[model samples]
Target chain A: MSTLAVAKKEFHDGIRSRVLAGLTVLFGAFMAGAAYYYTEITPPAGIQSSAEPQTIAVINSLIIPTYILLPIIGTILGYKSISGERESGSLKFLLGLPHTRRDVVCGKLLGRSGIITVSVLVGFAVGGLALYALTDAFQIVDFAVLTGVSILLGMVFVSIAIAFSSAVRSSTIATAGAISLVLVFLFFWNVVLTLVGYVAQELSLIETAQSQTPTWLQFFASLNPTGAYQTTSIYLLDNGTRSVPSNPPFYLEEWFGFVILAFWLVVPIGLAYLRFDRTDL
Target chain B: MPAIETIGLTKRYDGVTAVNELDLVVEEGEVFGFLGPNGAGKSTTIDVLLDFTRPTSGTVTVLGEDAQRESQSIRRRTGVLPEGCDLYDRLTGRQHLRFVNESKDADDDPDTMAERVGIPEAIDRKVGGYSKGMKQRLAFGAALVGEPELLILDEPSTGLDPSGAHEMREIVQEESARGATVFFSSHILGQVEAVCDRVGILHDGELVAEDTMEGLRNAMDREAVLTVEVNRVPEDAIAAVRALPGVSGLTTDGTTLSAHCRDGAKAAVINELEAAGASIEDFGLETASLEELFLAYTGDRPSRPIDKPTVAAGIDAAGERTEGHR
Candidate 1:
């Protein structure tokens, strides 16, 4: 009950803050505009229209918003949950309460998760409805799958944010570290893999060139939450969309990507909770 | 059972000891005052009691529970206003009160608490905009929100104006009257003297004196200064007065004679003066005050030693030895 009380208080304060509100409004506007443009402008032109069903266009529209918004919001929200409380001296007041340290950490995570979940659901609903009105087409199954993958991607980023927040003392530093980490996973990791692949090909390391790449690199690429989420999203929209594939075929094998994405979500958050539970603040 | 107890409790930072083997006990419902100068371990002792900081040695028990072992339980029943405490600036005064109330599972009626502390009108204002006195009052209100069984306040009167200080003192008294133990620390001797049932004076991390105000005064056997206007004051009469037990010093200003003697010696001195052919015009006994008593216990000179331990003796014999190299 006390945990719920804490969650409710945090949720109320979070929603009222100009930072969160601004982010929500900006993301809503951008996603709605993008959905409208994609449905109204691209399909009617038939300039390069593929034979894929319109459900594919709808999935692509939703995925575009998820890719652009989830990571930024996740990093911003979770990065300050603990470090900000400590910096503001509220940690002592919270510690003085009857709840255990574990309860505090879990309650904060739950509260932030609640906020992210609401924002994503609302954004997805509005964007999906706009796309449906503009294109006059929708696929419930693809939409559900896309929403699930987007939420999973958001959780992975949130977990990473929490992990870094617990390790840093200042809120600004924590937020920077979380953002840097997400950028590394999303952008830098792919660059490194591409370099490795080019170097391996030049050397002609083995007869089976595709198989010559290190298993660890493959594992890391698969563990990239953005890449995994993108792959899973594309597979779910296979019959409906003609959007560009976010990850190569080698990165999307079987259920490997989902298992790896789930690992990314659980492990970092679990470690973050452990670190938080033992910290003095 | 005692409401709070510490045995050999010590806290050390690096090589310096903040509180060294401190042993203290406050009886249940006692308004006990912990007195000390600026750096006398009073706040450290309170921190150990509240489990905000861990002690390096010994033990602390509050309300029959070991403070460190059962800190949560202790916290559940204890309300503390820590020294140099800071509150959430973004929260309104009422919000702060409600937060504390919800945390303690107590009733959340911020208006009543605010009214009691005389801040109801500004309850909706952010604490950041509050004056120092107002902040102190809000902190006090938070501590009293749950009405816990034991209230541990470290210099709770800091930043409070005279009226606010008086109101806080009254609240402390009220809390004690309702069967709650109130342990407060203060550098101001008069405030403690006004309400404390007993006080323990700490000088340089050690408990030098512990007794009620009257008990302490009596223990010191303080002297009363008596001024007498007399006719024909004789040298022999002055000598005779000095010769009496408890009479130590005498001075005469023309027809006026001032005599200093142990508290109960004024009457004997007067009787001796009258018999010695000195006609007395007026006489009065001045009782020792808390200030004088405090100085006597904390600021005595060791060169001229009395039979009992005076403040100077305590300072030199204990304070010096304990404070060496610290």
Candidate 2:
């Protein structure tokens, strides 16, 4: 009950501030623009109009934008949740009430997740309408799946940002942490995999030239949250969304991507709450 | 049980002891002024009582519940105006009050609370535009919801104007009269002198003195310098006062007699003056000011500027620094 109270305040605060409103506008614009790019603007360049909703033309474009947009939005939502309160000394005010530290942590997570969820909903509503207008063969189920998965993707990053916020006292460090998360998951995860793959192949851990990357290595790379979001979206969009064959190990299968995304959402906050609960505030 | 009690309470940050092993008690319905200079551990002690920071060793009980284990129950009945806090910038004062009321399951009217704290005019305005004093007032109003059993106000008058400060003191008195204990901290002596029923002066992480106003006045008597102006210096009165047990010293000038004594010696000296046939024209008595007594315990030499960095005492709550962990 107390958690809901804190979350409600956080929701009101987020909505009242210009940051969340700006997020909604920017996200909606991006999604609407993606709809045009996939249908009338680019059109996939071959089948005249493969602008079907469940096809690669629409869902792929929709999923690609979230890989980049959600991290930025999620980080913005969460980077200051706890650190900002600590800086302003308002955590003392909240804790001065009958709240435990656990209530605060849980409330922050729920509140921030709600903010991101709403932003995603607004963006998807615009994009969904555009897709319906643009494509003649739109599948409501696939579109609904896309919206649900995209929200989950954004929530994963919100948890990440909150973990950083709760674990560190300094906002500068938390901001840096959020930025580093984007860089590591969105950009550097591949570089790390390539370097490790090269080292492993050189050590003769696997066949050379036949495969520059091992099966285990490929499986591990695919679990990177950005990669997992893409894989999971493709999996949910099912039949003929893409031309790629789906014959891989069980660990490398698309359903594992959902598990990995869920892990991202739950694990970071769990670890962060442990550290936050122990530290003197 | 006392309203608040700490036995051998101490808090150390790394090697720096913020609060030494000190015992403190506040009875059920009195105003206690927790007085100290900056970094003297007054805030640290308050933090421990609220369980914001864990104590290094010892125990604390508030309203007969363990401070650490049962803090929620303790806090449910406690109202706090935290030191140096900023309100949510986008929240209106009414919103802030409602949040507090909702948290405590309280049904306070925000307008009535605002009126009490003198912020009714801007209660609808966002806190971002509020002056620091207005924010302080809003925080003060929030702490009053549910009519808490204990009110812990840390530097509650920091940004207030003179009238605002006086208003806060009156509220403290009102709360005390309603059977609530008000424990507040201040670096300023004047702010607490009028309303604090009992005061405990903290310096360098130690409780140097704790007493009522009268107790303080009697204990430190170098402050009681009495000067009597008569038509003639009364030799008999001077000798008789000199004979009193607490009369530390006495002197006679051309037409004035002065005595340096403790509490009870003054009345005897006055009686002797009337007996000696010396016509007393006028009289004046100067007791030690709170500032003088504060300085005496703080040991900050009056000749030196007060900005000197406090030397780390390197002592634990038990006194000397010991290596063994508890």
Model 2 misplacement above 4 A: A45-56, A199-212, A240-247, B220-286, B301-326
How would you encode candidate 1's per-residue C-alpha lDDT over A131-195 as one tens digit per residue?
A: 66766456677777887778778767776787777766688888888988778776698787787
lDDT of 1: 0.73
Q: Write the per-residue lDDT of candidate 2 for residues B56-113, one digit (tens) a residue.
A: 9989999889999999888999998999778899999988998898888899999999
The CA lDDT at A239 in model 1 is 58
The top-ranked prediction according to lDDT is 2
Task: Please write out the lDDT profile of model 2 over residues A118-179, one tens digit for every residue.
Answer: 99989989988888898777777788888898889888998899899999989889989988
CA lDDT of every candidate:
0.73, 0.82
User: CA lDDT of A75 in candidate 2?
Assistant: 88
Which portions of model 1 miss their true places by more than 4 Å? A41-53, A167-173, A191-212, A235-266, A272-281, B13-16, B37-44, B89-91, B125-129, B187-191, B201-209, B213-326
Model 2's alpha-carbon lDDT is: 0.82
Supply the TM-score of chain A against the true chain A for every candidate structure: 0.82, 0.91
